[model samples]
Target: MKQLILAEKPSVAKDLSRVLGANQKHKNYYEGPKVIVTWALGHLLGLKMPEDLNKEWQTWKMETLPMIPKQIGIKPLPKTGHQLKAIKQLAQRKDVSEAVIATDAGREGELVARWILEWVRFDKPAKRLWISSQTDKAIKAGFANLQPAKAYDNLYQSAIARSKADWLVGLNVTRALTVKYQDNLSAGRVQTPTLALVRQQERKIETFRPQTYYVISLEVGEERGKRVQANPYEIKDQQTAQGIVQQLGNGRVDSIVEKAKTESAPLPYDLTEIQREANQRFNFSAKKTLSLVQSLYETHKIVTYPRTDSKYLTQDMKATMRERLQAVADFSPEVKTYIKNGAVVQQKAVFNDAKVSDHHALLPTEQKANYAKLTSDEQRIYNLIVSRFLMLFAAPHKKVQQKVTVKFGKEQFIFTQNKIVEAGWKTSEEQRASTIQWQEGMTVAPNFSIKKELTSPPKPLNEGTLLGKMEKFSLGTPATRAEIIEKLIKSELMERTPAGLQVSPKGKQLLELVNPSLVSPDLTEKWEKQLEAIAKGQFSSKAFLQQIEEDTKQLVKEVKQSEQKYQDFSLTQKKCPECGEFLREKNTRDGKIYVCSSAECSYRRRKDPKLSNHRCPQCHKKMEIIEGKNGAFFRCKFDGITEKLPTKNEKKKKMTKQEERRLMKKYSQEEPQESPLAAALKAAMEKQ
Candidate 1:
């Protein structure tokens, strides 16, 4: 009898099958002399929806707002039922002796395999192959050193508790809000608090008024001389600022203080840090960054797992640092500096067993990337992970900081400069460091200038800053934070604007109507800490789930009892053709769409033009097909360039009646025999 291996996705199954010599391919699995490999399409089973538990919950009503079922069963996803059946068949095969969980090595990955094993009633012993990367060597090593599936039971339990908590709170309150408000509204433990953060910033911007202020600074020395900057203080009034600038004279150096400082290289990325960096550098959304890294990890096998919270590696990983660095050195030769004696330099900040759990920081695997095959985006993300890995072995940056204090009449100004000692991980900072000529009791001329400025309003939170806030509060795990932010946008409760993330009018109203506790991060933070405790087996899942149920019940009751009202600020003046009700404009990932305000009316259409394959010459993105006054044209939204679509058989433009009349009136002034142009125009007009 042969052992069976269950993988998370078909592509991964194929990889496992190839390495394990399971070459005999079947409709849903691959078989060999020793083992059989089958695959799951992401998740073949998910928790039952509220309606699936209770028939009464199918209808949206306040009476059934808190629908808590005794057993939240698992059901086959509608689209993946066939795959689930395939896995079941393989599990029961006579030739299969035991099973291996070869899915992703994470909390959710554990749930994916466990749900299937339990559902199929596979009685055989099971083992789990846990590896961070999908490289051939890693896969082989993982199979050789398999762990008992029982080792991950706590992780699976934690996944279940988290899932059920979200369902309990998300569903109960979402149903209550939608039914009470008479509109499709959404609220969640994570998304609601995130939306509130954005709204908080908006309120600050709205209430802020610019106030004029002045700053007094002095520029020492003249052009072509040893120029240094000395900033003294800020003045509230224009006259005061001018007086300070006008009374400036020769000054004597008061004192100087200098010290040596050093900064270690930044730690390698966890999932959130990389997402933040990609968002800031490429302007890519957090979701986009996650997907890119996921592809790099799964498809390319160039990076480790994409979802992690640790910024450190286990002590065991120290031995592999050289190999990881060597892989990265191929792309970035600068990494060569850190490799010596066939190993990377050891650093204390990088390896700590206590700091690593679940998985280590996102890292580049020993497998080198095939640069030609990677897209530009994939290359960018891979580089980020690799460069950070190289930085770990880099020496700490050392420098000496000097502070000079000068007394100019009644004012004292201080100047600081950095002198580079040894440029380590970051060379960019060294360029700003220079030796300033200053000492005690030295005399120098002082010149001052006053500048008027206005107090600026607070900047809105972008996806990067928003992710930072979410991470700070433990609002969601690295795996789910992007989805939470995306859900807010899809629900029409948040929008991405040039200024950054902003709450839409609908979102603002939803916040006012939602329970105040739901909008605060404190509640979610408490729940998240409890979830972490549950994962570690310190807190009982039953107890944590009980707390969640009680909290969810209270939140639903608060939403139902609130006297606040919700208005659909998204409604447009345009009326729907099918129903007399007004249509609402919704911003979707696919672009804007118009929908009938009346839910009963099934009328919807795309508001933006359909996209075509023809790329814009300027931006290289797919252009929209728009029907202009003459004919259809390809319009690039980013480039704002339009070009006419090529026609089948080139045809002359037909003269309009207005244009023909104007042309004939001007050219037909007893000049039918005057020129050939007049004759042509007369002939065209006659034909029309």
Candidate 2:
């Protein structure tokens, strides 16, 4: 009987098919005498929305929101319905005796396959073909020692819980906010926390006060007849600094304490760390770096998994170190020599099983990379991965760190120096050429310290350090972090300022309007802790999901009753000449025209300039073919001018500063009115 194997992606399925000798490829299945391989395009079936259960739920009404289904249902996307059909047919085939799950050996991967199985009514005994790499040896061994599918029940449970929880919170909160605000403002667990962070930074930057401080520098002369200028690291108050400078007068040699300290090499690169470094060095966005890494994995086949959190390898993978090292032998000669001379030392710090999860940090695979095939950006990324891989097996880079402290009465001044002691891993020609080193113990200054007073606000957030914080601290998974950042930007809740993502003025105002506890990282962290518990088989997925549904219900009720106002700062600009009210622009089949702000006024005018046939240079105001000193001059009502201007290669661009200020003012004055459902809910809330 044929054994069917299911994988996460088509690329992975192809890899498994090759290793299993299932070369006869059909529409969606690869067949051999003893094996048939197929794949799932990630998740084929997912939790259904409230609208799927009933059509009436589509509209954003308070009564219909906070939808919590009794039995969480799953439905296939129309685009992937064919894939589901294939899976069902494969499962029911009489020739198939048993099935094998060859998808990724992770929680999400397990969920993907399991969900499809349940949806297709697959009942055959299943085995798991878990392997980290796509190498022939790894695949062969994985099949040879396939494990029981029951082993990953806990992981599957955790995955389902995560999916359901996100669905519940995301849908309920998004619908509630949209209904309450009467706009398309959406919210999610991750999105809210992310929005809060940006808004907090913006508020801080807006309210930050700049202070002016003074510093005094002394130019001291050395014993070698050389004058060296040094600044005292200590920045004291202006009064004290002035007094100290007066005491020295011209130049005085202060005691110089120069001591040498050693510095060790940095740890190997993790996915997040690499992303951060690439962002800083190349100015590539986090999402862009991930996309490049995905290509390196799926297309080039030169790197391992790119979505991993682990920076170290497991002990079991140590045997394949030689092959992995050999893949980049030509690229890094120094690493080749070390592997050739002796088996590369397996440092526990770099190769510990406890730190490793389903996959290790991104490293070179056995596949030899064709550098010519890589784009300029890919080449840069691949080179970094190669260099980092080689650096791991090589010796640690050594350096000397120097710290000098000088005492001025009760206060002390400090200076630090980083001196390279030995370029161990960095000794290789390529590494040495690429690396930068500072000189050792060369006191080339005045050797005297000056007192200075300085004060500055917090620095802006960069993509690099922010990503590092997100990944290193388990703030969110790699997949979700990029999505959340994008959501914040799209929602106009967070804007890109000189310093990282700061909440837009409107974003801060919204936070104050919404429930205080709703927009917090604590919500995500709490859910994560529960998900982890479910993964460890210590908590129930059902219990966690129930909590989410109940909390969402209460949150919706609270928001529906609140008297706070929501202001959408998106507006138009046209003054009403009759009533002096700001004109709101509305689009009709005829064209764009201005209408009175008060809908009851019913005052409107034709805004089509083409109808008048004359374009004004000042404001594009159409004129009725007016005769002037220049024979035919266009008149502009807005600019109140009639002048000749160039028409070739000219376009009017909106001035953003004035537009934003105008919108903010308009929004601040007008408060949103609640929907009828919200009004009814408020009455019910009051009675309760």
Candidate with top lDDT is: 1
Clashes of each: 0, 9
For 1-688, candidate 2 gives per-residue lDDT tens digits of 9898998888888888887889899999898889989989888888887878878776668878778778768989768888889989988999998889987677778888899888988898999887656666667888999988988898899998888878877788778777777655667766676666656655677688866555543222321221123543343366665565455422222344445543333455667877888988898878888889878876677887787777888777677778878788788558768677664743447778778756787788887789889999998898898887776676666655544443333333444445566666666423122121223332334344443444677666677777765553355676557666766766667766654666765567667656566676776778877887888789998899888888888777877888878765543566777787766554455666667766457776656542355566666757543444465445566666665543444424534567889989999999898999999999999998
Looking at model 1, report the run of 10 residues with the lowest lDDT sum: 223-232
Which residue window of length 10 is worst by lDDT in model 2? 429-438
Q: Compared to the true structure, candidate 1 yields what TM-score?
A: 0.85
TM-score of each: 0.85, 0.75
lDDT of 1: 0.86
Once model 1 is optimally superposed onto the true structure by TM-score, how far is the C-alpha of residue 522 displaced, in angstroms? 0.7
Model 2: per-residue Cα lDDT at residue 308 = 79
Task: List the candidate 2 regions with Cα displacement exceeding 4 Å.
Answer: 216-239, 248-264, 400-419, 426-457, 495-506, 573-688
The TM-score of predicted model 2 comes to 0.75
Error of 1 at 540 (Å): 1.1
- With candidate 1 superimposed using the best TM-score fit, by how many Å does residue 83's alpha carbon deviate from the native? 0.8
Per-residue accuracy of model 1 over 1-688 as CA lDDT, tens digit each: 9999999999999999999999999989999999999998988888999888888988998998798889998999888888888888888889888999998888889999999999999999999999999999999999999999998888888999988988999888889988898788888888999999989988999999888877665565521121133432245689977776667779888889999998988888999999999999999999999999999998999999989999998988888878887787776656776675456654577788898888999999998889999999999998888878777777789988887777887677767777888888877774453445677999967666667878888999999999999999899999988999999888888989987998988899988998899999999999898888877888889998998889988998888778886677778899998778999888777889889989799888778798998889988999999865587788999979998886755424655578889988898786445588888999999999
